[model samples]
Target: MPNLDDKNAIAFEFARICSLAAVKIMEIYKTDFESRGKDDKSPVTDADELAEEIILAELEKCLPGVPVLAEESFAAGFRPKTDGAFILVDPVDGTKEFINKNGEFTVNIALIENREPTAGCVFAPARERIFVGGDDAWAGTLKAGETVSPDALDPITTRARPSGGMTAVMSRSHADEKTLAFADAQGVVEKVSAGSSLKFCLVAEGSADVYPRFGPTKEWDTGAGHAVLNAAGGCVRMPDGAPFLYAKEEVEYLNGGFVAWGRID
Candidate 1:
């Protein structure tokens, strides 16, 4: 139930925070970035903490009443208020790629209502592109170089079917054995890897045919991408073919398995 007129303000504000976080990340990327480990053994960095700090602070100011579930702050015992809905934030996705200075990392933010994503935004700071969408609109993609009118915003679309030669997308830095097996099972003829939610965007824009993620991913990691893909005539489905839902009561907020596709023809 987010108003589109107001959504831009919120999205713009989040974008600013993300941009700031991206700058901090870039600063770290330029130098010998520090590293540490979470209990799950996933990597963490100064960039992640700094960006999360900035994003969390801004969310506090901008959306004071709404509860926030962020990746960096989740381990600190912050359980979401499942009574209704909330916002999910991955202040920095693709931390490994960020560390590699590949510029494919992104800031992902999504507004979940009643366990469904109503609006979301993704910013590729280094690439200077931003993607934003809501249920009422076909998500819009903006790059640093183009002039786009509001009316000229293009609607995203998924491929009608898996291309003649399936082009499967995997994580650039986080590819796992299960993903490799899934791609092989699907008989993928081409494989492309990208960092962050760009995997979803690739399928949305028809650049790739499918994204099968068998590895672990938190709700925040896919909420924004889910909205984008759904708007683009694609879907994120559980392994058993159910639609993905967020704000589940589970404490971990971890997703099981999902296959993103334009369609399964």
Candidate 2:
């Protein structure tokens, strides 16, 4: 179990790693590349594999033996046991958005200990925005050709649920009737569509009140964003009102429905 100081340090490193992966993703995003389907029929591209390779290499150098469960790697049968502390990497979240050139994809990384994401970072290269949360939370922007650094970030936090009604952010690619119904039940005053983990970041920054994810998502898909939300005074929970957890070997890393709330009350 890492202490607060250790977790913060690791969180900073995770942000840097996500930034590097984001840069690689943006490079490929600007190219004329094609996507192919994975075994699960999810779209994957060279950017996903290339960015994951960069992130994995850096993780091995920075924290050797700390198990990493990355999207592309796991899809290729690299199932390393995550007994203690481990890293989760989604090299290019929102691949469909990326393929469509919607500029909603992101590079995600998280540090999980005891089945909880203690620290994480989400970087949207196309948008030049980075959101990090752990012992602290921050939102930052990157200029073209700029590198990521701690000094570039500004602290951010969640706001209380509005007195009127809450704003909700939903997935642009995966929105379905069930998700819309869930949002409607929450009394959402306004709805916004975004791709990738940015939905969680929006709630963390107080720009939105809640994000109900009724669609199927994997641990890597939400771990980093979950950490960010938690650090920013938010939480992600099961639809049945249980705390969301990670490293569920019994489920083969698949996550069920969840609600990420900016205000838990």
Output the number of the lDDT-best candidate: 2
Residue pairs that clash (backbone atoms under 3 angstroms), model 1: none
Q: 1-265, model 2: which lDDT tens digit per residue?
A: 2344566667777777877777668878889999999999999999999999989998888888889999999999999888788899999999998999988988899989999999998888889888888788888896434565667788888999899999999999888898889888888989999999999999999999999988799999999999999999999989989989999878778999999999987
TM-score of each: 0.85, 0.95
Model 2, residue 228: C-alpha shift (Å): 0.7
Q: Rate the local accuracy (lDDT) of all candidates.
A: 0.75, 0.88
User: Which parts of model 2 have CA positions greater than 4 angstroms off?
Assistant: 1-5, 143-145
lDDT string for model 1 (1-265, tens) is 2243465445455555666666776677678877888988888888888888887887777777788889888876777685676788997788877777888988888877778776676777778766665643333554432433335455667777653678988888778998889888878899998999989878877788889988788998998777777766778888778877888666578888889986676
Poorest 10 consecutive residues by lDDT, candidate 2: 1-10
lDDT of 2 at 142: 68
